[model samples]
Target: MTKIIFKEHDGKEHPVDVENGMTVMEAAIKNMIPGIDADCGGACACATCHVYVDPAWVDKVGKPESMEEDMLDFAFDVRENSRLSCQIKVTDALDGLIVTTPEKQF
Candidate 1:
């Protein structure tokens, strides 16, 4: 399992152990992390699972794919590091990944 951190808009931190091959959004939903609505259920069809990859981990997480990028156009508060949590698969290399939720999910 990989240890990932989800920081809420209010500055709350939720640390969770995510299984290999699981998406980041799956971990947040399983752990009850707030701000990750995941309305599309990791389908990459919606932006409710939007998150800003911690700047320090951006390189490791890499950029969002074209489809994910297209969906992100509907996200709130998009940033250079903004990504759809559903698009980020957990891996051993991302054991310490950190992501921050936006002020709003819509």
Candidate 2:
């Protein structure tokens, strides 16, 4: 299982065990992490699951695709490290991935 750490805007941290092949958004929603609204349910149509991938793990998490990039443009609090969690697939190499939720979702 991969260990996913979700840091909220209020500075609260939540860690969850996620299986490989599942998307970051799926893990968050399954674990009840509050920040991810997942309004489109991983269809890449909504940006409510927007998050900032920790800089240290950027290389590991890799870059987003053109489609995900387009959706992120609609997200609140966009950042250099911003990503749509639904676009990230978990892997054994990403066992200790850390993601921070944006302050708001719209």
lDDT, candidate 1, 44-103, per-residue tens? 999999999999999999998899889989999999999999999999999989999999
Count of backbone clashes, every candidate in sequence: 0, 0
Model 2: lDDT of residue 40? 94
lDDT of every model, 2 decimals: 0.93, 0.94
Model 2 steric clash total = 0
Name the lDDT of candidate 1: 0.93
Model 2, range 1-106, lDDT digits (tens) per residue?
Answer: 9999999988799999999999999999999999999999999999999999999999999998999989988999799899999999999999889999988996
RMSD in angstroms between candidate 2 and the native structure over all alpha carbons:
0.6
RMSD (Cα, Å) of model 1 = 0.6
Check candidate 1 and list the clashing pairs. none
